[model samples]
Target: MSSIRSPFGQDVEKQGIKLPKKWNDTNSKIPTDRTMAVGGGVAVGGGGVAVSGDSSEFPRKRRQRYVEKDGKCNVHHGNVRETYRYLTDIFTTLVDLKWRFNLLVFTLVYTTTWIFFGLIWWLIAYIRGDLEHTDDGEWTPCVANLNGFVSAFLFSIETETTIGYGYRVITEKCPEGIVLLLVQAILGSIVNAFMVGCMFVKISQPKKRAETLMFSQNAVISMRDNKLCLMFRVGDLRSSHIVEASIRAKLIRSKQTKEGEFIPLNQTDINVGFDTGDDRLFLVSPLIICHEFNESSPFWDISQEQLAREQFEIVVILEGMVEATGMTCQARSSYLDSEVLWGERFTPVLSLEEGFYEVDYDTFHQTYPTPTPTCSAHELAELAKKGEEIPLPPLTPPPIQNPNQNLDGERGRGEWDEEGEVESVSNGDVKKMDVQH
Candidate 1:
């Protein structure tokens, strides 16, 4: 058979064609091991689209590797919890500041500094002993309208804030006053830098990154189309879309190594929705993420009762680009085993009214009981089999014997049963023994 040739590229280097000297000399080794076919040509790795990680899948496929770290990047202490000794997280402290507290602190510093400098200027005027009075031309104090001490204090206020108001002016005629003005101006600049720096740090937090994103208050176990599933709701409160949004669910639990070292291990990824491709959701509205209890599921063997006692966490993270800022943003929340509700479903929160979609935020956290199996999927299947094998008890029909047959003949048949009467019906015959005498 002749060898087949491809037309797209130069599959056949025309007969006797030699390679260029540069192409031949270059170390042109191509990567061959990015993909390896193991066992009868089954490709395991070469650049396959990575399966999204959920808390319920194999850890080997879902593990995260540490890239790099620096001293400033790590925070050791917090206002709410002591993380380490002698180390404070300045970023966290700045982000946590309340608007009212920032305003109050700024006001106190402004007032105190103004009064302190005002007292200094007042004393300087008294020592300098100069005044600008009316045409009377007296040493009526350098301040034209106010008393000597009052004038100095007012001048200090004007100089620090506005550099100088004409009502309280400083001139070289009083050498002492002129020197004091220069010193106060320098002090005012320093104060301005300090106050403005604090305010700016507080105002410049990346709130947009975390805004409008939140996880459901509780995780739920319910049946979606007869398939048992673990579920939680994630939503964005803003109308601005999150571009290329991807979600991940991780089941974290403490694991001990053979070396006796214990660490939090992400057991697997809980691929949400229908299949592995279900990780990305169109989050135009509140979306319920679901993990089915199949063989690949972490909750396959876990029952409602077992879930309540287990110590584990379902960590959900949503990452996307903010449409408004074009900056990458991530929002995360966790559900401890205690927070997972079995046999409950989230109430409907989205509806269309008058051609407009409305979201009922009041019911965002509310869940109602659902018809769900309390046993694990495997256990329920076994119970269903057992039920099929056990045949139902037969139902016996009532006997055809007549009650009047046992009655005495002394009671005539014509008489009501209130007295004593008997009537008997035999096969194809009716016999009545009764007489009215």
Candidate 2:
């Protein structure tokens, strides 16, 4: 049986357990697909949490997406027959529709209302005997030159649009027609205001503004301020800035509690300097946002090796007001555990140029290898508590000096004199010793 290092600081056997494919060796070639089906059990705390189904019965456990990479919710309502709910808030419903659908609805609304009024105009001319007396110039018809449905339809268009072609002017012969004209004019204005507002709101949506606010392709894990931090870069492509921008992150992962309660797609908040107010960013240039792996961090237990066996997603959210429009905008992106690079740091992409600082977007996602500890933050904290000292280089010894040399590296002036042993260094007087054999 193969052994797996459990996160609980123990080795557990992989017997009768089916691990997710991405949880294998880090150096192994992993599949690009983040979807996985783990059918068996995970060894936790020396116990196997087995599933109740066999391979044929269960087949595979599909992982459902809570939030897509683009920050859209992956939920859909089914079997709800409350059609009136959408009708109650019809304006919002129309605004949320796709461009093609909205355009079709916009066209149909005007066409249908125009036809309904055109049918009324046709019926009025027919009942008033105006259609048969079009050639009788003495007969003042309710609508001049009106004879058929086609003319009525054209008249409806001309009236609603205020074209006033003057050929189909309404006469005072039919006062009932006068009342219909006033009603149609008021109804036409209402429809115009409603439909045009929907189209205008749809066209000016702030969703597209988020496209200019870009997030880095990948997130990184490296040493920062003597702590392990998860980092990602964000920037704005437009010259106009995002006012009062702030960023937040969430860790999405499945968890099994101590009581064996399984919680799928659980989300935990990842602090990106909220306490220190670093979450509020001045996004003039591309800035690397960092989340320190402190005691309260979700990634505190994730080491470089454990990272390879971890399957979790980090969703980053950036919210700010558009400086040009004064409207709030939000941008989002996610990084799977596979996208995180350990023992690496993002390269410098900002440089000083003439008159201003220049930001290079080309190298925004580029990173280079750096020395980082492979241990988890918890393990490092433990080591720190124990006061463990890192090994240092060996010390060197001083050079040896000859006794015959003075401090200046010159020969001593106290040499044996011819008369007696006269020792004198520098200008000191020599004391002669009588040599008695």
Candidate 3:
């Protein structure tokens, strides 16, 4: 029998019949590998996609950072109509400012108040003709050393700071000068309260405590208790423990609604076992926080291959009260798609010692390869369902005969033979044993 071949390009070539000129020219440089161009990345045949790192092929675009790796908000507010809002909450604004700005404001507030009051004293001295009669011993100036703005300024500092050097004194002859001194004293107290309070609050900020609370540099995905889990390690460097600590995660990605509305930087919650109270951590040592892949998870349908192609970030937040100060503190870290490792698990950083367990921070962020399925959790569940449907062989039953039953089915009766030998029954045969002397 002769085999018939389809009229494909290869078959036509073998038959010495070439395709048209235009068709051959267009298909000459076709790639053998199955690859699809999606956006700026190439999807491989293994369901993985790779964004080209080469600048010529694809120039890298900077992703908008919602939260920086150091847990600072990268958002900047501008064009605000309520410009006076910051001043209305001036105390809070000053407290929130950086150390340099706070110190600058503190210095300026005291200096400006002092200079303004000094000008008033100098004006009073000039209006009373005290500057003109400097040599007259009879002329009692409002301020004893009423010569120029310098003397007035020196008196202002002494009055506000309560440092009475006894050289410069306010005279009782000028009742206006006495009232002015009273006013300066009250204003100086107010200024001290505002400036000193801002500095105190800024110095005692809990933000610095978060520095000792660390997160792993990279996140990893692997099987945990027969389920795929996304995990990251968190540990505290200081000896003091955090009280009532809990961890939370968010998936930040751009998404389009079913109504075709584009929402940029949409946040979705990733459960770290909050329902089962697993999110509350003891945190005596380094703990691996796991987010199990389930239906509610955004990564439920994401496979190891698709994860590399995803353009998303996972922001982790850890909140707790400082054991020493009893103040709440929050620490945050993020993992980009490039920072996530598939089919990998964190190396053990804790070990048993003589009296207590020891944590090795050197291996805190370390991870190693692990055996894991590349398929999505949804696909794995479907495969598991199909496996359950496949019928298994039935089990065989054993005979229900009692061990003490005799060959005649009599109970509690001994069997003996007349030849002085013991007889025992087998499947369907009897065996004789010789009597021992």
Give the alpha-carbon lDDT of every model.
Answer: 0.58, 0.73, 0.73
The TM-score of candidate 2 is: 0.74
Candidate 2, residues 29-144, lDDT tens digits: the string is 33333335343332222222344434355443333334555566554564568889999999999999999999999999899988998999999999988888989989988899
Q: Taking the tens digit of each residue's C-alpha lDDT, what string does model 1 give over 21-69? A: 2334336722332321121112234334243334234322111111100
Please provide, for model 3 over 1-437, each residue's C-alpha lDDT reduced to its tens digit, 9 standing for 90 to 100.
12112111001011222223243454563232322223333333323455455424653223334566678665556447897999999888888898898889899989998899999999999999999999999888899976999999989999999999999998889999999999999999999888888898888889999999999877888778878899998999998999999999999876778997667678999999799999999988888899999989899999866775666779999999999988899999887666677766666767779999888887677664445688888887887878843222221112324433332232211234554443433223455545443
Model 1 is weakest, by summed lDDT over 10 consecutive residues, at 65-74
Query: Model 2, poorest ten-residue lDDT window?
Result: 390-399
Which pairs clash (backbone N, Cα, C closer than 3 Å) in model 1? 53-269, 54-268, 54-269, 54-270, 55-251, 55-269, 55-270, 131-141, 131-142, 132-141
- Score residue 39 of candidate 1 by CA lDDT: 17
Global CA lDDT computed for model 3? 0.73
**Candidate 2, 389: how far from true, in Å?**
3.7
Which pairs, if any, clash in model 3?
A: none
Backbone clashes in model 2, listed as residue pairs: none
Question: Which runs in model 2 stand beyond 4 Å of their true positions?
Answer: 1-76, 390-437
For model 2, what is the alpha-carbon lDDT of residue 113? 82
Candidates 2 and 3, the one with greater lDDT? 3
Regions of model 1 farther than 4 Å from truth:
1-95, 98-100, 131-149, 174-190, 193-215, 222-229, 236-252, 262-282, 291-301, 315-334, 343-354, 360-437
Global CA lDDT of candidate 1, please? Answer: 0.58
